[model samples]
Target: MSFRSFLLIPLVVFLLKCAGSAEGRQSGIFLPTELHPDYPGCPAVDSSLYYYPVIGILTHPGDGASGRLSNATGVSYIAASYVKFAEAGGARVIPLIYNEPEETLLKKLELVNGVIFTGGWSKTGSYYETVQKIFKKALEKNDAGNHFPLYGITLGFELLAMIVSEDKNILEKFGSSTKASSLQFIDKANIEGSVFQSFPPDLLKKLTADCLVSQNHKYGLSPEKLQNNEKLAKFFEILTTSIDEEDQVYVSTARARDYPVTAFQWHPQKSAYEWASSSKIPHTEDAVRVTQLVANFLASEARKSTTRPDAQEVRDNLIYNYIPTYGGKAGKGYDQVYIFT
Candidate 1:
């Protein structure tokens, strides 16, 4: 054979080897159904001792430290506190980084019973778009029987509202204009005394008589604008009227308005500035109560999924003790007990 024929022979062998390697990789991708391990389902139980796993996602801070910081103390610290509170009542906590690709993040989400969206600096343009996309996808899966619970803090709370409403206007109304340090309140008048009122009667009662909400940040939701925004109007309607007051617990923050997702313009995790500011700790009791309430809410949701009736009473007790109490001068008795529902 000529030199050309020899070269052709080697090329054919090389192609054959490459084909075999690719086929092998393909086989590794799909495991056999029988090879997958299956544990016995959880037996029916009447105890509150059972535990559920919860995952917390950390967002990228727009300060160019997208990958450097996983826990922005203010966000992570509060989240960790909540996780500990949840564990005290029988729930496992898992912290996950949110910088992964969408598919990988979704896979990680599947492993946890619930999700917590931590607060951080907001991104710009396509970055925000991608972030919103992931949230929307997770919500869709959750609604479609995935059974995963979701909670957001600060910026995460804003994202949650945006996702549920699917209103891009959220960005235009709040995102584009407000600075991180600004605080805005919901304008109750826009709702025209409807259920969508910024402060529903129940929540208004809590704020006026029960809790002392602070105003620290520069930006917040304007109840009037939120109610007037044609798209958001419906969401506010559902959150106010449809969700049962007994099923939902509202927390008063250092901000305005009443809604499902409890949001605080001030960082409760900032123990120094928030608690120890002025040679005396401020709102320490309130902070502790907020953390406990969050933990209790998560535990209650988990119990519902596990069908553990024994935990119901414990859950009710928690709500009864923690809900804010009304009476006396507003914001005068800064007792932690007042915030406990």
Candidate 2:
């Protein structure tokens, strides 16, 4: 064979090898040799998990609705810490003003992936009715296979318990206000499918060993009451308990049996966000981590939501449209608050 023929033969073989490599890559049989810090295993992106999820936070009545932060009447407010918590978990927030018209509130629900019932003092009146309506809406969304989730904090927790039990008097008074407490896990406690599932083993242990979370509510559900109440028992399982100042054992955390609903009788956001000197909020590294991981769990659950609304419409209703008042400077319970009349 001629020398030129031999060179041509080598070039043809080289082209075939390159084409084979390309085909293998297209078929996902080939991966990059270089490892990136962000993509350590070069894992495929999960298109099913939404990266742009929006969470709706329901507003509470009064200025410092939970702690007497402000005396502003005819106004509703959402603590900035709650907003920060959602954002920390990679989710944007929209305020679901509790006192808004039923039509407006329902419309806003359609635009969100998840909802948060904030801590507040108002457990009765028009606010209570609004919460009931929204809670049912969330359940309906889940029933329709939308994968929507709800998080209830403090008063929010009490509301969920009351709504589920259909008994407004389900909550009993406990001297847990302004206290730093440690969680005591219950027997057969179900954490495997909860926000605590994302918690590191060490942190989970510390939750029981140390006072890593804060409690500042006047009312809570006892373990016995939760089990005996047919409705609450069927809806939520007690996850953790804490002793109040009066030596009363109350449920500190609980998770829904079937739905993506979790409730906290303590303030998980205070550790990392609030700087109120009056609070017994823990600021240790582990405490801050508890706040972060909880928020991360919320965002993760929201990512599973099937509702993907128009971006422009979401942007218009975001919490950013309202400015946060620096309530902390005035010695308010919250550092910042988004007040709406």
Candidate 3:
């Protein structure tokens, strides 16, 4: 071949490969970064089907007398709603028992792509040293370029805030409304590129009209508290706020800085999975859609991990060695007392 013809052949091949990659991205197969600027640094989605993610729901100390019926000391449980939430988001769920040995917990963490610190009544108390360690380890993994996602709801949210702020006193007794209410989208520009980036316009719009968020805690982070605090202001960008019945404004949701960590002061799962007297949870069509949005988003993020827990690990941790129980209530498609010994 002539010299110019030989060189042209190599250039054509390289350009063709580049065109194929661009076509893949243009077809909605994307890296997390392309989907949203806040996404973790992870492998791009290929044309292959997405992985079915698994979630570890951390069980914790209970707060009330309702668990008096169970033989366990403190109810280490997850709402059936959360299980349904995971399933709806195209993932499977498992219980992460607290106090497990660090190695065992670490093994399980390696198996799942995400972990959820469910809400409970530990506002003024402490998390199991194991739970704390697991959380810290997950943070380290994400910081080290592993795309692991952690979600905290209600008390879970408070706990994360406490951890990131390194201030035990960051959470305070709300003293205002704890009833179910919708949220006000504050500083829309802030959430524009975060986890909610893909929100349907109608779904995002309903945040103002629908009573979708179920609030049940007396302890929460207010906007003032978030702004004035050094650690919190630096660690999270507040995405939404709500005016309680007593006109008190609180920080309802936040996304972490430089990580795929998200938290909510309101119970997004309650509207679909919880129902107790005085719970006052929302159950409207809008409420269900909002719940599903969160479920799908988190699950989708969970799918970003390039690995899955081993089958033996799944059997040992989620199925064979454990017994599931219900809380005596009906949630989406499961019992209230779900996934506890």
| Candidate 1 wrong stretches, greater than 4 Å | 1-50, 62-89, 125-130, 163-216, 237-281, 284-287, 305-341
Question: lDDT per prediction?
Answer: 0.40, 0.88, 0.72
Q: Quick one: how many clashes does candidate 3 have?
A: 6
Q: What is the lDDT of candidate 2?
A: 0.88
Per-residue lDDT, model 2, residue 234, is: 93
Q: What are the models' TM-scores?
A: 0.48, 0.86, 0.78
Ranking by TM-score: 2, 3, 1
- Tens digits of per-residue lDDT for model 1, 54-126: 4433434321222122234322122233344446546654434444466765655555555555555464454
The clash count of every prediction, one per candidate, is 24, 2, 6
Task: Please give, for residues 73-111, the per-residue lDDT of candidate 3 as tens digits.
Answer: 545556656677777888877677665556766777777
Candidate 1 — number of clashing residue pairs? 24
* Model 3: worst 10 consecutive residues (lDDT sum): 326-335
